[model samples]
Target: MCRCIRLQALIGLLFLIFMVPEFKAKAQVETIASQRQLFVDDFLVDQLERAELEMHRPVDEGIAFNLDKLWEGKFSLYTTIIKDGGTYRAYYRGLPDVKEGNDRELTCYAESKDGINWYKPNLGIHEINGSKDNNVILVDNQLTHNFSPFLDTNPNAKKSERYKALAGKKVTGLYALTSADGIHWVKMQEEPVLKEGNLDSQNVSFWSSSENKYLVYFRTVDSGFRSVSRASSTDFNSWDQGVEMKYGPTPLEHLYTQQTSPYFRAPQVYLAIGGRFMPNKQVVSDEQAAIMGIDPNYYKACSDAFLMSSRGGNNYNRYFMESFIRPGIGLNNWVSRTNYPALNIVQTGDTEMSIYVNHDYAQTTAHLRRYSMRLDGFASLSAGYAGGEMLTKPFVFDGSALELNYSTSAAGEIFIELLDEKGNKIPGFSKEECQPIIGNELERTVYWNKNTDVSKLIGKPVRMKIYLKDADIYSFRFY
Candidate 1:
């Protein structure tokens, strides 16, 4: 009897150690439903069998337009682009000469029908030099320094406040501005919204549909490094105290501008393509700088654009530490604050999106350039010629068919298989039965045994195993 009791106790201990944890994990399975999942990070990854996540840089498409206007010159910066219906609107600070001080800074405007070709419309809103026949929108010296605006998407937002902006310096804190047509602007209140940070760089704000609040990411000093802080508000006028953004274990670097905005496709995920400034990282010598007509003080330091993402809150995922948009092969490209990306990423074509960058800063050739990438192509789950596989964490999805945004070489192919919560292969969805996908398409529907319907698996927790051979999977979704 004593021996039997001891054996029973051992059995109970083993069950608690293994079974309990497995049950807990299954209980916490993610309900992904039909949301698109990008390979920007390992959020959905459970195991990798020789597969790796690779970052893809955008392809340089040359200069979109030059800041050659009389009012717009080399010092023009802080660009923000918005795609409202068929019209693409652009805003930036136009300063011909920095020596003229803050009084010379003015907010300029430009518009585009397809986001590629741009034209500056003479708004006659603010007078500059001797005439009002310029594209100057606002002339406030304090706010025009870094006037960033976005088309408000909040359903509750009033029509008069359809467009909103935040602009100010450390001395004035940050002020809120609203516009009905995104051209004329008015102060939302007499006092600043939140006066807790340095508020010097491009302070980006947008309405977060997932969090149901207005979110703002502004510049703040953290342990002597230029960092970012976040605050939220139900109403744009009032805001929280804000918290310093935490980057897990990554070395601190000077982030000059945190251009945080929700990805148009995946509004829950916020993408930040900001300028990473390296003070005193000089590459251009005195003689080299002079030949390129570069600014003396600006040549000492250099900046490049980096990519980071956040689901919501004050935490950012810096999965790729490398530059998103590197400087081109020229002395003018290697200058301070040159490769800074604009505020937003706009879709230029059905399968193409564009990111704008300020190139050749502090020089006579300074202008905004365009870079293009395939839709959801920021990063990809890649496999080499040797072939590899990846298993995803168990998730309950609500869909009937699986679709993927992927690309492959002529000899490359991708196969997907569904598994039960216990890692067992689900019948009819086995890798052996999958009709190998082999093409470079933006949205290709996955099929198993020539069958696309998976309605029977809806609401049931399952895992996905992907096999690849010289192929890249940018993103996947069920529909």
Candidate 2:
């Protein structure tokens, strides 16, 4: 068997064995309703339906190759998909333009209303490097940074104070970017927030359920291998250096790569990572090392992706590809042999997720492609249900309403409720559950159509207590 097949099979088995529970709740099982606990019927709802990627281009025709500029003279290495106010913003790395060399790397900006059709922001926003036109934020090569924008309503909340962004050269040092709004950031003075500790910080994120910080899968320089690194932080600036999570593809193996980004609506704490293959070792080198040396007949390479979870950020589980139907490249060769994920994956609505990426072939500029999908069986499960555990760690809130996502497998009746911090259902909302379109996937949205007064619960600390015995939860968003 090919090494790719073997690696994939191993990952699949690992996820099924440890995380997902093959539960047999009998058809006639009694509904167990408790005071602190509530029950929804066992209805299967396709919350997230993986959709085929659609391409968007800044240029008129053909692919727009290259990353968005987060800094001047820099390429966008990692991106955080964010919806600022009404407009959608893809805040990404403005990695140094290699054609210009390291000394000139900087951060830049881009904006879009629809996730597609991005426009480079001409806000005339100034940068750290005294650049006014290039849209460059920082132009210094001594400290390279990327991926630090996070969404938080309460600017003064200390618990929500972790300033995050990837910095350093190949040695990505974790740093902090502080902003009153999601835009207009100021790099924290006491930076190197996460120093060159034991683990290399590649990409960073936090789970809402646990209200904690996390670092994405990484490769150790020593082994030249990649894997997930786990850590905890109250403030984004500092981290409790963590353990390396083991699962799925590794960089050392032939083209095996995995990554993490936010999931749309299932649970606020949900995160997805994927695995892909890197056939040639030289891709990591300065030049196109493998392309210049490797024989074409040797490797059948394709990018593979996966998913993982963390409540408070300190702990994590390795994800696996558990589909009975094997995954293969379906369309466009734009993503072929690519190094960075095009655009950041977005949580469109509850359970609806689409990872936006761009690729430039020998065509025009570059086109953007969205990889969308929904996970069924998420509702019947709780936070980390695969592990038979919910984020029961008493979510301490800054008075943010918990955004809930619900979907059904077969067309059936479903009811939901708002539970106070004390776990009692609030009054005046829809008492009877409402049914949305059955089976089809619903994106990052709640059944707000049913409950007209969703506002009453907005400013309070509450959880969108979903009572679908048979519904699937794609994700939840907590303020």
Model 2 poorest 10 in a row by lDDT:
30-39
**Residue 105, candidate 2: alpha-carbon lDDT:** 47
Best by lDDT: 1
Per-residue lDDT tens digits for candidate 1, residues 1-479, read 99999999999888887888563435357878888888877778999988998999999999888988877888899999999999999999888846424678888999999999999998988777789899999988879888899999999999999999999888888889999999999999978887889888899999999899999999999999999999999999999998999988788999999799999987878999999999999999999998887767788999999998998878998889999888899778888888999999999999899999999888888789999999999999999999999999889998899999998899999999999987899999999999999999988999998899999999999999999999999999999
In the range 1-479, model 2's lDDT, one tens digit per residue, is: 69999999999888876776553222221111111111121121212122111112111232222353434322334445666546676654454334322455455556766555667755566544464555444444534344445554234454334333444534445556565545455567545565543332234554343243444333343255544455555555566765565433422332133345444333333344433434443222323324433223322343433344443243443322331112334222312333234323454445444455433211122234455544332223332222111222123233223333444555332345555544455564433443332343433333544543355454354433444334445443443
Model 1: residue 310 alpha-carbon error in angstroms: 0.7
* Top TM-score hit: 1
Q: State candidate 2's TM-score.
A: 0.53
Model 2 regions more than 4 Å off:
1-76, 95-101, 126-131, 142-145, 153-166, 170-172, 197-201, 211-224, 248-264, 281-304, 310-319, 322-339, 342-344, 347-352, 361-367, 374-479
Model 1 lowest lDDT segment of ten: 21-30
lDDT of 1: 0.90
